[model samples]
Target chain A: MKMKQALLTLTATAGLLAALPAAAQFQKPEDAVKYRKAAFTVMATHFSRIGAMAQGRASFDGAAAAANAEIVADLAKLPFAGFVEGTSGTEKGSPKANVWSERAKFDAGAKKMQDEVAKLAVAAKANNLDQLKAAFGSAAQTCKACHDDFRNP
Target chain B: MKMKQALLTLTATAGLLAALPAAAQFQKPEDAVKYRKAAFTVMATHFSRIGAMAQGRASFDGAAAAANAEIVADLAKLPFAGFVEGTSGTEKGSPKANVWSERAKFDAGAKKMQDEVAKLAVAAKANNLDQLKAAFGSAAQTCKACHDDFRNP
Candidate 1:
């Protein structure tokens, strides 16, 4: 728990620099858009697998659930790396300008989501279905909340 | 190198069992398709970042390149977990039936690509541009070759 807290702090600190796109990393703003979208896609991929289990759409196999949750947690830190100012205002599934203008709230939302996903991973590791369900619900709420305010759709 | 050798042998061995879809891991074949596509998408995301630097389309920031390459190496092992017989037909980016019909060649291709990516990671960590280029080129070729034979593109 202490280690997760420390890592969360570090991720929050990294978020400070996140608003500024690393010029050397992307040749254009669209590349940043692509980067963030790709990260989100991966997040969706793993999350969907876990969600299916949670919803009873799929069997709850302990090992697969744990592995998927682990990936979701690790991937939680990646999309924010692409949330630069240049990426907003594009029509191609890019964020609206409010994401940057309301950066604090946006960042808080991101951090909360990350924390929730981390919890999901812990729950998955514990092999406690109840805990995993609660954590997954919390994580999903954070996702919906963030998207409601920050995303295009 | 010993560890890499061990992983490659293990991965190659696992390939022997790849044609059998793990019903425990995926309840539906589409889930497997989605999973592997997501893995490939993530791999492409990170690999392209390094590819840009290797091809001179982006700056060669040593630290970023190394970080990306390391992720690429890790992600290299993921997509195969999705390539099962259940996913070998139809579209939506699933493998062509030839992928299963020629499973041996496909697995060999997969192994070779993973090995080349591992080499790229080493080159990136060394911050040697020439080595990175060579390894990146080789890895890219492996990707194209595999797709040409196994994928519908």
Candidate 2:
């Protein structure tokens, strides 16, 4: 069982790394860290715009929701590339060490979020408030799940 | 002539503001500043990847160049939204006062950059290194023009 689990982890890690553009894209570990954080910041800003409409805090504009959702989906593919090895931090809101140790699980979470956001993008384009709300909830849950599992509190 | 230029600045500022999603997207001036900086950082990262290929510092990968150029084009529409009122700074690399004081000229520069990047995206899709290089040089010049005119030294 231990050997099988280790093999699975290796496969998962390789798959995740293969999805990245190139290690050369980031010349230093710090660059990777900064890139990932900036990606998250931009993604979150757009995501929150959708959240505002879904929660009734802001008026529902289908065009705006669709635009924001599209940006979110595009950005979803980005931050994972920045999760280079040895860059996990102990600070609050930072990725925990398990991001590397349990690399497969972390990669799974990233994939889940991306999948949810992609769905959210499609749903937002439907121009129905109910559909946007449902999709936003699912996507937000995926974000929380990863933060709970892999990020420091 | 001074009055004519003032009217033009007001018209340009209004047009630019109208293009943004809404002023309510940002809760505070700092948020706008941070959001814009994050957008620029992500855009520059992708832009630099293309630059590497264009300058022959890295191997020319047509597909990669196309992907980077597309991201740059999409991002060209974003950072300008973050240039809210009273956010200009005097520090090096910050937006100069002229960004707001000479709003029309600044907006023109922004549009020029967007146009160049859009062309770069199309050129990159041709998958010809020469075409990519030519488009990349034009796009880079737009970036520099804005930086030279609107950004502080």
Candidate 3:
């Protein structure tokens, strides 16, 4: 039994080691694109759900709204990590050179979006539709601001 | 400024009270339909991303795989909550009435899917590709199982 347990531990350790290089975030440019896009899509999905409620187009399920807000806040941190160097190839890069060139501005826009989404999460948890609307619009503007300058149209 | 802040607080409080009179859960069947569809779409998108890696079409990004698995696990909890009562209208409801009628069976299937997805998250995080594949297939089976029985064809 002790031998079997030891073997299991060894196997588990090997598997854990396999999972990391230690992922200096992504392994490739395509990875940067795909990861960022997936995270963005998830954000959009959750945002639209809350949008429907805030707009009064759908009946607001407070719990669902709050849950989605939390997820959106969490997702807000994901995209920028994908905005690393060497992801500037024009063919695979929808993000323009300004992301790397105007680094301070791009970072500020990302920060603004994250901050706005975080506030949106707070408003959502409080069930403050008005605050949610305000924060959501703010976040959307940040998205557009960065995209307009940095993203390929 | 103090008076303006107070007035703003007052208006916000009134809006919150108005938004909730109060919702026990969802007040719209259409909300349920849209929410579930959105959750399912997110799941499908993430699964396809991982599927591409697993099938060798895309390079395996360990971080991306782990991130996606976590999202899938979170999303697993979402669609089932949307499958609440009074979501029985066939037009707005993509879920068949059997979801409400065969509630026990449906709940079990949902649980099975959630459990499998949670396992997939664990496997992905561990970088155990073999186990990830196993859990991925299990989760896919659950999707097909539930859809075959309860979702619209």
Q: Report the number of the highest-lDDT candidate.
A: 2
Q: Interface RMSD for each candidate model?
A: 3.5, 2.1, 6.8
Model 1, A92-146: lDDT tens per residue? 4558899889989998998888888877877787777777788789999999998
Worst lDDT 10-window in candidate 1 chain A? A13-22
Question: How well does model 2 score by local distance difference test?
Answer: 0.87
TM-score of 2: 0.88
lDDT of 3 by residue, A1-153 (tens): 653564345334333433443235465666666666666765776787788887888786777788888778766666666676757655533888778888888877877777677767766766767777777788778878877888877
Candidate 2 residue-wise lDDT, A1-153, digit = tens: 999999999999987678555455899989988989988998999999999999999999998898889889988998888898889999998999999899889989999999999999999999999999999999999999999999999
Which CAPRI level is candidate 2?
acceptable
Model 2 chain B worst lDDT window (10 residues): B6-15
User: How far in Å is the alpha carbon of B70 misplaced in model 1?
Assistant: 2.2
CA lDDT, candidate 2, residue B145: 94
Alpha-carbon runs more than 4 Å astray in model 1:
A1-24, A84-94, B1-38, B81-96, B151-153
lDDT of 2 by residue, B1-153 (tens): 653564355345335434755457799988889888988988999999999999989999999998998888777777888888999999998998889999999989888887778778878888999999999999999999999898988
Evaluated against the true structure, the overall lDDT of model 3 is 0.71
State the DockQ, from 0 to 1, for candidate 3.
0.06
